[model samples]
Every structure is written in structure tokens, then in C-alpha cells.
Target: MAAGAAPVTTESDCRCDVMAVTDRDCAGVTACPGDRGLLLVAPGGYRGRVRDPNLTRSAAGQLSPERRATDLRRLRTERFDVLIIGGGVTGAGAALDAASRGLKVALVEARDYAAGTSSRSSKLIHGGLRYLEQLEFHLVHEALTERGLLATRLAPHLVRPVPILVPLPAGESLRDLPARAFRRAYYGAGVATYDAFAGVFGGGRGMPLHRHLSREGARRIFPSLRADALAGAIRYYDGQVDDARLVVTLARTAASLGATVVTSTRAVGLIRQAREVTGVRVRDLEAAPGSPDAEFEVHARVVIGATGVWSDDMSRMLNDVGLRPGIRVRASKGVHLVVPRSAITGETGLILRTASSVLFVIPWGGHWIIGTTDTDWRLDRSHPAASARDIQYLLDQVNTVLDRPLTTADIEGVYAGLRPLLAGEADSTSKLSREHAVFEPMLGLLLVAGGKYTTYRVMASDVVDRAARRLGGVRPSRTADLPLLGADGYAAMWRDRADLARRHGVPVGVVEHLLERYGTLTRELLALIDADPLQASPLAGAPEYLAAEVTYAARAEGALHLEDVLTRRTRISFETTHRGLESAGHTAELMGAVLGWDAATREREVAHYRARVEAERESQLMPDDATADAARLGAPDVRGFAADRGVDGDSVELPTSSR
Candidate 1:
């Protein structure tokens, strides 16, 4: 194969026979070679034509208001084979996995999808290099494999390769030369092992191999590095993603595969008959403030909990039935600070070793992300506030090698997320395992927790495999070859970006921005802009975002609240210095037009969003988690739904007419 050329596969290159035989043994299907793998057989065992993966393109996958309403109705009326709690990446992946395998699946989330840890990650789909030092080869391999898949086959639109530079300090003394050489050798060996694993297991290959650079070479690549701070640097590739977008894409993909995805609905308790768990009792948190809560039941053959940090809460709900969950979740909070890209002036991302955890100075669009502090957190899971101490710690660590130090004034945004590390004998949160564990505490109940973001698909597949044993006749997970909603024709769309920009009468940069965010779906956004040319203009306050995106968030994405659109969907909230307050009203107006919100309701949404931003600011100023949690909780939740930390029994019922 030539450089950058697509590979051609012939009949001999097909692994269908091997995959079909393996799937048959796992799924207990005795059908012959005719009825296996991607090739579907007729009723009489005659081999049918091969199915075209790209044949279907339906707007049914779009999470518009109509779809949400229809899905909610389906949730209340239908019984599914699998009921997945939490619409985070793991649950979304599980829904996709189960649904793609020809099983009925439904996923319900308490808040907006990816509102938790999924959206707040460092945005890297890296094979854990630190894990290799910990002798966790399996984890590194699994994460690398998933990373390759995301960057190439699965979500090429969302995931891309990011080159990182690890600096090595210059040796001044003659005595220090051997020590420096040893350090370099040690780091090089580890990185080589990392690359080897990626090469062997990574299915979709795109990234370049690791390279050693001289100090001058390193400085040439990253001129911002402080002089005399490094002897040289090692460059390596890892995958990066729009974490929140990946979650929503997963949910949308799952929805496209016939899974009913409902957000803004809380799972109050497990519906149990005698000793076996069967379904969930849920409450619509979108109920009018001061109105009675409307509750309903979603029955399923099996319930899978993928609620990340809130796993313990879900487990506690099952405890009421006298079924004690063996796995316990220990929450660890990780915080990241975002500054403008001009602050660093680096071509590649920097990976600096910190005393406690690794610091990543990642390059985002027009901004750089510097993070993170890993500490045990027992505060409110919903809002894990980052304190001044945490901010100072990150700044102090990153400043060690920066030519220009970043202060609080330089920060554009700050976000905090809690990792659901499964409790083990490890003393520190950093020492805890990233490997996930699945448990069946009851007959129809399943719980999956602990894994890192990179291995969510694997975790999802494992959980569904367990569920398949319970619900017989369900095929194995087919998500390995599945492309996310916007991934199928992304490469082609990217190649024709210039033409798209010319056709749409927008700048090439604008088209490129849309492509990076929406991939091939950029065409749909362009269509919206074409219908109303004004929609092509930048937002009133947040010029980085187009007005059309705000409307699209509500119309096509499942953004019920203004905060959802600003904060997660477009990232305007944290990306702006005003924390999206300036654009709040205008954005809300766009959303209101789609959601049919009255003027009063639009005003209220804007007010609520500003209050939320103020609360977040106040929380960041607090000294500790306790005070921060109190400050954050001071802001009213959009739907007035309080955290049901220890609630028991069925959800409180409101009038059915409230629906």
C-alpha cells in the first residue's frame, strides 16, 4: 500500500468465516456458514445478499423535541430487553451494543447526557502510559485498541491524533550525565513499549510512532518551552476527542439503532417483584417548579447501571431489596483549567510529570487545556467544585517549564469531574484501578463501574455480554465495526470542505470548524444556514459559535435547558470569559423558538443560566469541597429537582395530566 492510500480487501482478506464461527459458539447459534456474521441467510438457509452499511440514513436518530416526546411515550408503554440507567458514555455505548445486536434497549438519564464525568474529561482517548509503569499491560492494550477504533473506524469525526512532547531536564554537572542518560533510557523504553502495544492491538492505525528529539529539535517543535529547562524531548501520539460530543453521538447512534433514549428523567428506585429486580421507577425532572412530580415505570427484562460516580447511589437503591452490591465506588475528583492557545505558543501538547499526577497541556480549538489534580472527593457528585487550591496546584505545576507562567487571569475556564474508581485496598485514589467490574446483585439487575473513559466500549460490551446470558437468543456486541452517526462519510466531507464553504458562501475556516465539530453532519447545519443566511452569522456574544448551532441544539440535539445547550452542546459556557452569560439571552431565544418557550420562559431560562454561572464562580472561590458544595447548591437546579442521594421506594407520583 502507498502512503495515505486506502487498503483494498479481497475475498481472501475477509475474516468473515473466522468471526462467524466464533460468534456462533458464543451466541449458541447452530446455523451453518450461510447464517453467520455480516451475511444474513434466508428462511430456507439460502445466503442472502450482503447488507450495505451506508444504505440507511434517517433523521429518526436526531434527538429533536419530537423524538424525545415519542421516546418518553415508548419508555412508559414498552418493555425492553435491556434498560440502561445513565446516558453517559458507558450507558450510551451499552444501549448501542445491545440494540445493534437485535435486542430491544432503552436508556434513561437523570439530567442531560454526558452532564457528568463524561463531558469533563481531559478529552484524550490515550493508552495509559502511566499504567504501563504500574505494570498494567492489559489496560494499556485495551485502551490503545479503543483509541485506534475511535480515531479511525468508529468516530473519526470526533477523535483525532494528538502529538505530545515530554521534556527531559538538561544535565549541567559531569556527575549528572549518567543519571540523565539513565532517565532518558528509562522513559524511552516505556514509550517504546507503549507504541508496541498500540501497534499490535490497535486495529485502526493512523498515528506515527514515537521519536526522540534533540534539545534543538524539541525547541524547534515547541519554541515556548523555557530555555535550559530541558535536555531533549520525546514525541508520541495519542487520541483526543470532544468528550461530551462523543457521548451524545453514542446516544444518537443508539437511538438510530432502535433504542429509546430519554433524558431529564431520574431513576428514583428499582422496580422489584419479590427478590428479583425487573425495572425502574422514574420521575420526570422537567416538571414545572412547585408542581407535583410526575412518575412512571419502565419495565425491562434486565437493568444495567452505568451511572459512573453515582454508581453507589444506584447500588443503594437496590439495597432496599436486601440485595447488597459487592462492588463499592470511591470517587476521585479531577480538575482542569482552560486558557487561550496564545498563552503557550506550542505546536504540540506538553505532558509534564507532577508530584501527584500527570499534567496535560492539551491544544483545543483556539484554547489550551492544563490540568489536573486527582484527589479523593466525598462532596456532591452532581457538582464537583474546583477550589483555589486546586487551581493554584495546576498552575504551579505547569509553570515549572513554561516560558510564561499562567495566572488566574489567564484562565478562560475551569471544570471538575469525579472518576468512579472501584474501591480497593489502595490507599490513594491515584493507586486505584481503572479496570471495570460487572456484578449481578440480583436476578435481573446488572452494575458496571470503575473503568476509564477510553475503555467505555469494552466495559459496555462486557456488561451486555452478561445481560445476554440472562436474556437468551441475544447476539454478541457488534459495536466494534459500527460507525457513529457523523463518522460514516466524514473523510469525504472533509476533503470537500473548500467546495462546501464556497457553495454555502461561508469562510473556509467556518466550514472547517463545523466539520471538526459535526463532521459530515456539517452539511445539515449548512442547510440550516442556507435557509436563513442570518443563522450563518456568529452568536451575539460568543462569536466562536454560530446562532444556528444554538437552534440546532434544541431542535436536533436533546437540549431541554438553555444551560444544556450553552454548557455541553456548544461549550460556549466554559469557553467564554463571561461563562456564556452575555450570550445566554440570545442563545435562549434561539432555543425557545425551537422548544416553543414563551417570552417569560425564555427570560427565566436566561436568568437561571446566569445564576448557575454565578454559583459556579462562587464555588470556585470556596476553600474546600464542603463550602464549594454549599455554594454550588445555593443555585437553584433548572428544573428544581434536588439530588436524591438517599431517597427510597418508588418516585413520588404527580397527576398523569402533568405529562
Candidate 2:
């Protein structure tokens, strides 16, 4: 056994090797590192089959344990058209775009898909309305266009319009009328412009137009508004999504289009051939440190780095190869708090202006998603910390207009995300440019940085286009009108949800839940429930989810770890009061059934999730950033993913983020 070789066990007569050449689970395109024959066994005993007994694949967009191993073997031998270095939305988008255009593609993430800023986004898809004030019209228009595609043409099942209210300031007396009217005019114009941009941009038709609401009228819709806090309100529409799910769908869609996607594999360094950048040197983070498969080199004609907050790290890879790097990316921190819907008696999401930035009180299922503070972050990017001060600041701002002010006790969960803003002379992170830029430090390497979540498709297209131009004979991006994994038959399925539930012998509510999460793919879950009636039972700790959903995530959604199941695959970590602790053991058992985790491994998974929750809780209690970040260090990240993995202010787990 040698380094960068696949693990093999000698048999009585022959040797088996992992290899990849087709969409099938176990086959090889090339010779094994040492073995004479390729007998690729999909990880976790796949035996050349998809876990779904009833479904078939034209290479289905399924990311499971089996595909992960098959793809890893492909990384060792296949020379790809493009290799993307991040698994966030942008990287996943690039993979989908390139692969759809019939180019060979491979993507590697040090952590799970969307394990960084992509999962921690504000979860909105709109042209940043505030950016209209900054006159970044082009950026806003571009984002609005992408928003339309995501909500309407692309991922209608995941991205949908949410009604948002812009609370207008009400004057205390006649003396303040002039200022109040002027303020109303300003916000009204902004909302109007936002709508106008959407309509003109193509995606705006999915949502209703902006409407002015009187104080009395606004209160009728949102009864929790403090009477004196606002005179009138302007209601507008913006899109929202399950950000992490979007990334996973993008990765899966890429795989369906013949891309090799693998997670927990970190891009340790660049693979250079003299003056030409060739590929990347990667380490399998999930592999045992001294194992043969721990480290490998992936050859790509061109490499696209969508590392976001970790963009500076791309520069360091250049320096490691004795080249001066030229990408400048800075990080902006945004913290969000989740509380029960009962805590905030609002039907429509609220957008309140702060001294520096706007705050959103978005409505989620049975909960209110409130956020976020925009400030510069210089600590631990893997686990950006939000202090007591950050939490207090948000409560203070939203309390000014709430009939009953929320307290720390009202908070159910807290998550802090970092935005990769383009470095500039702007005085604050909020003022920095949201526009993304692309740079090539060498002939074959491209670094893409500094874009908002809404415009990820555009950012991906630009970078991959650059790679395509260099590589030649590539088709233009086909993603603009392409529907994601479950979007195709979603509307029809939603229309028949009641029948779907009745036919599956479950409640309509259950069918609705699955439709929203998995779209037309809900059939797969229904099949699971049909096969195992017990699969229909709701998670005892979090009834919002079903046992079958966890099984599906493990079997088809590439959930290799517990955090992948609870935190990203589902929002149980933040949506549940127990922060997923009560459900951790149950989820681990469910995933273990698919990934072959033993009792000890299941216990380790539960303990890791428990420690992570406690660490985040303690970090939030701290009064300032330094103390908050230090407190987060109390728990080690799962799979040796320390906040800083062997570098000063550098993390192997690259992140992408923001508003």
C-alpha cells in the first residue's frame, strides 16, 4: 500500500480496487494504483445499487456513501475539465454549470456540503434592496435576475417568495410630521425601486408588488407592532430558501450531470507544473492520518476556487508554490437568532433599519428567524462567534418596535456567519462592495471571491466561463433555465399533496412537509414509509420531521456525519428547543443504519453534536468577540476539524457567506 492509493484487501485468488468511469456505482475508467483489476465497491456495502429500491437513475442526482467512495477513486485517476475547491453554494453552482455544459468536473470540500457560510445565510434571494441606496444597481439587477431564476425557473420547490414589511417611523406629535413624511417617502421609494428592478429583471413576477399599509392596517396583519414605533408600513416580496438544501441539490444535480463530488477532502495545496497550474493536492479529512488514501493529487485542466471567506487561502497556495498571490477578500460577520413563532406575533416578516444596516425578522415554520449584525470578523472563520453584545444589540434594535420586547430567554438558537466582502477603502463591512471578482494567479488556477448568496449562479458562471475559455470547446452555461433536482414535477405534486398523503396512508400535513423539503423527490420518502410503516413515525423530540427523512438524508443526501443530518440536512439543531440533543441518538441510529456506524461510532456522533451545542451556547454568553471566539474553542470540531486546522488564522474548512 502506498500513499494516494486506494485501500485494498488481498483475497485468496484476486485483489479488489476502487475505480470510476461511469455513473454506475462500481466500475473503473483506468488502472488501479497497484492492483491488476478494478473491483470498486461503493462504500457502506452498496453492492452496485441505489438504496432506493423502487427508483432508477439515468445516473440519478443522488449523493450517498457509495457515490462518495466511487468519486474519491475517480479523483485519483480521472483528469477533469474543472476541479472546484469549495462545497458552498458557489462551488456547487460552478460544478453544476460546468458539468451541465458537458465538461468533466470534480468538487472537493473539507467539510460537508454547505457546512460553512452557505448554510448560515440570511436565506433570502433578492437584489439587496439596501444596495439600491448605495447605487450598486448592476449588482442588484444581476442578483435579482438570479433570484427570479431560482424562485421561478430553477428551484421553485425550495426558493419561494416571503412577504416582508418595511416598518415606517411614526412621529410622536405634529412637530415631527415633516421628518416622518420624509422618512416614509425615502423607504417607499426604495421599496418601489426594489419591485421595479425585480419586474424589469424577469424574476419579480413570482412575487406581488409593493403596497403601502396604514398603521391600523399594518397592525391588523402584524398585531405585535408597537403603535408608536411606526406610522405606516410598506409591504414587499422577497424570496427565501433553505440555503443548505440548495447547496446539496446543486451538488447532486452536478453529479447527475457526470461530475464527481466528494466531501471531507481538503484542498491542501496547488498542483503546479512549472509555470502552468495543473491541479490540486488534496487530503482526505475523513481518512485516518497514516492511511494510504489520506492524501492524493487530483489532475484538472483548470481549477476554480470558490472558497469565499477562505479566498486568501488560495493566495497562500500560490505563495507555497513561490508565486505572489493577488486576491484580496475580507470577512464580515452576521449573526442570526431563532425563536418560536409565539415569541413574535407577526404574520409578515419585518425589516427594521439599524444605524448601520437593516435587520430582518423573517417568518419560518412555527418560528421567527431574526437577525443579524454586520461587523468585521477577524477570528475563527470555521466557527465565527457571536457574543452577548451581538445578541443584545439585535434585541435592543428590534425591541424598539415590538409590543412585547424579546429577551435572551426567548432565543432558541444562535448562529453567526461570515460574509466575504471585496476588500476596499470603505469604512465598514456593510459599506464594502457585494460585487464578486475573479483572479487568476497562474494559467490553470482561478480564484472567485466576494459575492452575495443571491448571485451565486452569476459568480459561478463567470469563473467557470474563464476556465472554459482557457480550456476551449466548452458549451456556455446551461444552468440559467435548468431546474434543480426536485423542481421539475413539484407544482403538480404540491397540487396533489392530499391525494399523495391519502395514497401513502399518511396525513396531508406529512405529505406537505415532504413536498416542501424534497419536492417531487418526496416520492422516495413515501416509498420508504410504504416499505417500513414505522418510518412514518415523527421524530419524538422534533415532530416537525419524520424518521423517514433522516433515513433519506443518510441514504441519498450524502449525510456522512451526525451534524450533516441534524444541522444541515434538517434544521433540528436550531429549530428544536433541545438543540438536537434529544434527537441526536435517534438520528445517529438512523444514519448508522445506512453508513454502517457501530454503537461506539453512534455514541461519538451524539457526544460531538452535544458538545458543539454547548460550545455555541457558551460562546453566545460571552460579552465580546474575543471571549466569544475563545469560548467556542471549548469543543473540538468533529473529524479533527479544529477552528484553525494547523495554521495561524487559516482554516482548512473553507467557508462562503452572507446576506
Candidate 3:
């Protein structure tokens, strides 16, 4: 593996080029000397011809309709050692871990990967500083260790340390000087402890401990704060990551390690004989919209239910034993609102204590991600639309500290997600535990429920470690030390990023963005540009992303549907001004070519995606959950792709019921 070189194609003798063909161009196909001997064809679109990873030249991209069919056929024929049920961070982590450990692995998600709570998180990969306040030393230590790994060793490209300022209230309380000193001394000790634990993974020298600022200094740093509110603040560092990209990369890494990763595949039932669980009954979601009916069972040696909120549903499939005792999965709704960066101008993020919980105004791509109301949610789990109350809660909290208040109009995007808290019989959902639980709820069914986003890897490693024992032949989990696909030499890559950007004729900012998301794999994306110079151009509607990424997502990253490409594969839904409506058609057009969709299919994808946006808007308009669910139902299936899988070929003429 030479630096700046491309991946070699599979041998022609054993490999087949998986490029699709349109009726428009048939003469473009050419057999090339590479790993997969099948002829590659030039793909049409904004980018230059997709590059052959092995050949390094712009060869036709594989993922043609015919190749997709063959790939599906091969997937159906194969048996994986471990079948992971969710495509959240935990499940994705399990897939990567299992594959790296030499186990045959397959990960199935009913929706796009990380389409649930994973993408809708606070976007920080930090050790919970609040946990330290609660005296959960062990949890803090463990999280700090993972955070260090993510920042330095594992995903330095994706995760970087962000500084946060926690402002103390203005006052004439006890000795101001001593209290500031005490707070700094106390919090500093905790950060130092975190740093010490971080050293075990790789030193956390880059992450600084807490430092106290004077009232004047605090005001200088965050001018929006009420100057009279007069106390100082403490600043500390924590790693932030694009949660969606982490999961996407994890899935890709698993695939690179030989895991069968499928999106839009629903696990309808648990395949079982007598009391023991075996495989799963899955329906292919990528089929035509109207088609439905049959479900096929995918048999596997072990099943891991990393379904999170839907864990109960997976548990019920295997009878009462499948559900663990005292396993109360409560849904706590956390909503975030994206506002323009101009709303809060500061070098660092602001964290203040609200009456209910802490408020975070974190910075994202050219915008501020202000969030999170932790309230009870007894609504539809799938599409947790942000309610008026959810939005109001955030606005009120953010408005409390800002000089210029923000209204509903300032909101660029609003999203709501359910946090699977370990349910307790408390009157309030917030009182439930964020700590996760893994249970052998039933024979052959392993369920992981109730965890936060930061600890997904630990949860995943634990679940896979357990499943390994059941499968008989097991290898120790290697994900702890394993860098994801794009992680190798990322630091060095970052150093040479400017030169690479110049060579590729892309902006330095674009190169930085690519490095942040893909790490060393930026080279892979760059190869797409290298073969055909046109690929270097940014997407027409969504300039934030290069056009080649959309292609790379489908071919290399396993995006099965349009929504997978827009929503999870890229943060187009939340990051864009129109929630991806303007870009949906273009994206669909790009992906539909690869996915084998005709013009009609392309239209359907765009129409369905637009309806989904409209429905989400309508849902947010409703007063409550019931009304929201009804209004949301008015929209088309955004996940219609998942509904199409496993339809029977034979239309069995069953005897009509004679009443």
C-alpha cells in the first residue's frame, strides 16, 4: 500500500466489474487490467468517470443495476457468522469489530444507517462533564478513554476537540475570588483525572483542562451574556464528531473488512425453532413502492438486537423470555434547533444550566446547533418531529443569555429524537438513567437498550463479545485498537492537506471538510477527481458536498436509497436551508442512476422525499403527539424502500374464503 496510490482491482479471473449501463451509452464499456476483470463503463453525471479503486484511472464505476442484482443474489446466498440488528453506532461498531476479529458479519437496518438517534445527537464525542458532577467516576473514566481514542488514534479526521464555556451566574455571593478558585480547582482536577485516563489510549495533550475566567474576561469571550449576571466561567475541551459520518464510516469500514452491510432492510421477525432463536425474517426495502408481501428468513448463528428504542419490538418476536425483566425503555425527547452563526458570535460554545437541564449551543458547519429539551415523549418513535413546545423550550433557554433574542424565524432547521433511557417508574422521564443495559433477553437473542451516543463502541464491543461465545468460534474484539477505514495516517494527511488540495484543484476549506469526514480516505474520493477532473466540482444544489461523494456513498459506502444518501450519508436534511428539498431531486437523479432507477423511479424518489419534508413540517405544526403522528402519516413513506424487500415471486392463488 503505497502513499498516494490507488487500490488494486480484484483479479479478472475471480472478480466481475459491477458497473450499471443505461440505454443512453453502451459503447463506453472497456475491459481493464484490474482485480475485477469485468469491463468498466464511463458513468454520466457532473463528476468525471468514477475511478477504479485498483486501476487508479477513471474507469466506469461499478454498482450498475445488473451488478446490484448479482450482489443481492450473493448476499442472499451467504451465511454470516453474526447478524447485527441495528445500524446505529453500536451496531455499526459491532460490525467493524466483528469483521476485524475475523468473524463473518452482517448488519441490517430497517432505515438508513444512523437515521435514528445516532444522527440526531449533540454531535460531541466528549466524556460527559456533567457525569462528573453526578460522581459517576467510573463512567466518566470509560468515556474519557473512548474520547481520547476517537480524537487521536481512531478517528482524528472526524472527531476534534471543541472548547465549551460554562458561565456562572452574576452575584454578590460568598468570596467571589475563592469560589472561582475552588470551582476551577475542582473542575480542573476532574479534567486532569480525565486526561490521566486518556493517556492510556493515547495522551490527551491537545485537550486542555478547565481554566477559570473573570467576569470581564467572560464578557469579552461571550459578549451575549448579561454582563451584570456577573460571575466568571470555566472553559474545557471535549471532542466533537459528525455522528452520522462516524456511523457511515464504521459501516464502510465493516464492508472493507468483509461485513454484509444492508440499508432499508427490516427485520420482521425472529426465525426460531421451538424456544431457540436462529435467524431473521427480513423484507427488502429497496424494491418498487407498491410491491409487498413475502418475507424471507436470513439464518445466522447469533442475533444481536442493537435496535435501541425498537428493542422491545425485537424482544416481543421471541416471546416473553426475549424481553428482560425490569427492562423499561422510556423515550425522552431531545430537540435541537439550528440557527445561523451570527446569532451567537463567539470563538467557543456556550453551556449554561437551565432549570430542567444543561443547555448547549454548539457550533457546526457555519451554524450554531442549539438544543435539547429533555422531556417525556409518548409518541411515534420513528419520526420524532420537533413540537412547538420543544422549540419554545430551546428558544427560551437560548434567549435567556443572548442580548439579541432569536425568534422562530431565525430557525434554519428543527429536529427531535427519542433518547432510550433505562426506564424507571419515575413520574418524570428525565429521572430515568442514561446508563445502558445489555441483556440476553431470550435464547439466541441479545438485546442492547438504553445508552447514550458517546458510549456506543463500548456497548457494541460488549454485545459482540457475548455473541462470540454463543457462536463457538470467536475472536477477541479488536475495535478498541482498530482505526476505522479512513483513519490510518490521518494526522499526516492533515498536514499535507493543502498540497493535496492544490493538486486536486479544490479549495482548502473543501479539503478540510473532506479530511474531517473521510480522514485518509480523502485520497479515495480524490481518486474520483483525479481520473476525471470534473468530479472535483461541488454539487450544484448543495455546494457543501462534492458531487463525487454522492457517487462514493452509493458504490463504496452502501447507500441503498435516496434518503440514505441525503439524510444519513450526508447531513443535507439538517444542514441545508431547505431541509434538502432543493437538493433532493438532484441527489435522487445522481443516486438513481447507480441504483438502477429509471426516470419514473427518479421522479418517485423526489416526490416521496418532498412529501416526507412536507409531512415533517405538518407534524411539527400539530399541537401534540397524536395529532403529529396523524399529520406525519399524511406524508408518503420516506422509508418506502425498506418496505419492498422479500416480496414473493409467485402470486399464490389461495382459496377464497366462502362465508
* Cα lDDT computed for each candidate against the true fold: 0.80, 0.82, 0.70
lDDT of 1 by residue, 211-261 (tens): 999889999989889878898999999998989888888888777656789
Error of 2 at 12 (Å): 35
* Least well predicted 10-residue stretch by lDDT in candidate 3: 650-659
Task: Estimate the lDDT of model 2.
Answer: 0.82
Deviation of model 3 at 455, angstroms: 1.3
Evaluate residue 576 in candidate 1 and report its C-alpha lDDT on the 0 to 100 scale: 79
Global Cα lDDT for candidate 3 = 0.70
Candidate 1 error regions (>4 Å)? 1-58, 288-293, 648-659
lDDT pick, better of 1 and 3: 1
Candidate 3 or 2, higher lDDT: 2
What's the C-alpha lDDT at position 627 in model 2? Answer: 99
Q: What lDDT does candidate 1 reach at residue 349?
A: 93
Clashes of each: 0, 1, 15
TM-score of each: 0.90, 0.90, 0.84
Top lDDT model: 2
